[model samples]
Structures are given as C-alpha cells and as structure tokens.
Target: MANTTTTTPNAAQDTLVLIGRALIAYLFIPAGIGKLMGFAGTVGYINSVGLPLPEVGAAIAILVELVLGIALLVGFKTRWTAIAMAIFTVAAALFFHKYWSAPDAMKMMQQINFNKNIAIAGGLLALSAFGPGRFSIDKK
Candidate 1:
C-alpha cells in the first residue's frame, strides 16, 4: 500500500515554501524597482527621516530588495539571505516606521507599516530556521 500521507505532505511542503518565497520576494522586487525609478524621491524621504547618507541607504535598500531578494526567491543560500533580510526588515521598521512618534494624521499608516515589517521579518526568520525545503536550490 502507498504511504500517501507522508508523500503528499512533503510535496505540499515544497510548494508552500516556494509560494512563501515568491510572495516575500514579490514584495521586495516592486519596491526595489520603485526606488530605482524614483531615486531622488527615495533619497528625499530617507533624508527627511534623518537617516545618515540617504543615497547610500537607498542603494543598500535597492541591493537588499532587488539583488538579495532575487537570491531569496530562488532559494539560493536561503538561510544567509533570509538573515540579511530579517536584519534589514527590522532596521527599516525602526528607522522609517517610527509610528509612535508620528503626528496623529500619519500615525496609523506608519504603525501598520511598522507592524507589517515585523511580521515579514518573523517570516524571514522562520525561513532561515527551516531552510529552503525540498524544491529549493538549498534543497534539504
């Protein structure tokens, strides 16, 4: 008799992991592309937030979202890339999404964004712990 339960779950696990990677990477790719397209505006925003070296910050953001993001989507060196992304996510949340200090009108939006970043970071940490699963380049 076929051991249907075990086999199905493993296949499902691979597909789910791939989907998770895709969704997470999807968020970054468009964001990175937007930054590339609007470099000056991004720099202005970064500067407004009082981050040092807005240009450098923008560039690092681009690299993390586009370059490292692609690597993550492909599950290439998943754990390392996930860790980097997790760190970046936390830093960005702290730097850019300080909703607690925002004026009332803007506070809600910033709070949502801040919480979202934390959630994404949590997902990245989970990925780092689980690896890329069976279908990934870092296949377990």
Candidate 2:
C-alpha cells in the first residue's frame, strides 16, 4: 500500500511573507537613497565613527542597501540577499551602535538602535532560512 498526502498553496502565508519583505525593504531602500543623495554627509558620518575608507564604506552600503535591498523586496535571490543583509545589519550594529562605549546621555538611544538592528537581523535570518515564498520572483 502507498500513502499520499496533498500540499496546497498557502495564499495567506505567501502574502504575509511578501508584506514582511516589503517592510524590511522599506527600512533599507530609503536609507540607501538618502546615503546616495547625501554622499558627503554619509562619508563624514562614517569618518566620524573612526572607520577608514569612508568613501568605500559608503559605496558598499549603497550597493547593499539599495541594490540588494530591492532584490530582497522582489524576492530575487532572496536567501543569499537576506543572509548578506543579516550579516551587514549585525556588523553595523556592532560598529556603529556601540552602546556600551556611548556616553551616558547617548547610551540609551544607542542601545535601542543596536537592539533594533539585531531584531532586524533576526528577521532576515528567518527569511533566509524559510525563503521568499510563492509570491516572489524566486518562486516564479
């Protein structure tokens, strides 16, 4: 005897995944565009953080947040994109949101930002593991 089980498309789950992708994309796409438009300001901020090669950093940020961010939104190469975004988010939190080293007045704000980045990274990791769902170009 043979046993069989049927699998059905989950429209709700797929829609939720698309919405999650959109929300994540919203955070990076505008941020990337802002950095691109204010190239000097972005470089200056990177320099202020005492990171070398601020220009290179800014360019890489633009590429990751803008280009790869759009890819994430469209669910193209989503697993790799999500993984890259997750890693970048964690690195950025560690480098830029060093709340432990922040002044007393700024510590709370920095900590909040750091935690937020970590949470975002968690979401991205989940996306990477589960994939972009049926609504994505990847599924097509």
Report the number of the highest-lDDT candidate.
2
lDDT of 2 by residue, 6-76 (tens): 56659988999999999999999999999999999999999999999999999999998999899999999
Q: Using Cα atoms with residue i matched to residue i, what is each candidate's TM-score against the true structure?
A: 0.90, 0.93
Best by TM-score: 2
Give residue 43's lDDT in candidate 2 (0 to 100).
Answer: 99
CA lDDT of each prediction against the hidden true structure: 0.92, 0.96
What lDDT, from 0 to 1, does candidate 1 have?
Answer: 0.92
The TM-score that candidate 2 achieves is 0.93
Clash count per candidate: 0, 0
lDDT of 2: 0.96
Window of ten residues with lowest summed lDDT in model 2: 1-10
Q: Check candidate 2 and list the clashing pairs.
A: none
